[model samples]
Target: MSALLAASRASLRASKAPVMALRRSVHIENTVDNVLPFKAGKHNKGKVAVGVTAFFVTGLSLPLVAGLWQLYVPIAHARSK
Candidate 1:
């Protein structure tokens, strides 16, 4: 029983060093910066902003309009009846 406990403790201590080294090496400061798909240049800044805004507006409006149409259809049918 004592030999088994000593072997387990030795294995645990051996495993701990690699885990500590990994924790020290894996830091946010050492990490690479996230790459962007396109570079933001001065000439295309406005274009990028407009494109993003248009994308969000269209993306959001489509679902809203669809839901409003769905609500309106039921109301219209009830009124016609």
Candidate 2:
């Protein structure tokens, strides 16, 4: 058991050097030009708006729901004597 433990420990220590050597800093530019690069921004913008609207409507998270629910949900009668 000690021999197996020693071998595993030695293997783990040996593996660390290559992993450290492979580690390096990475830089990614975050810009609309770099990310989207759309030839027609106006059409693409409208498409994105439609997609986002569909997503929210499908998820039932539209902002007007809370206010509309008050108008739509049936009001309960008073139970107090």
Best by TM-score: 1
TM-score of 1: 0.50
**What are the lDDT figures for the candidates, one per model?**
0.78, 0.68
Candidate 1 per-residue C-alpha lDDT over 1-81 given as tens digits, one digit per residue, 9 for 90 to 100: 999999999999888776556665633432233233554566677888998999999999999999999999999999999
Most lDDT-accurate candidate: 1
Which residue ranges in model 2 land beyond 4 Å of their true spot? Answer: 3-11, 14-29, 34-43, 61-81
Off by over 4 Å in 1: 1-35
Candidate 2 clashing pairs? none
Q: What is the per-residue lDDT of model 2 for residues 1-81, given as tens digits with 9 covering 90 to 100?
A: 999999999999888767667776855465654454333255577777887789878678655777677765555323331
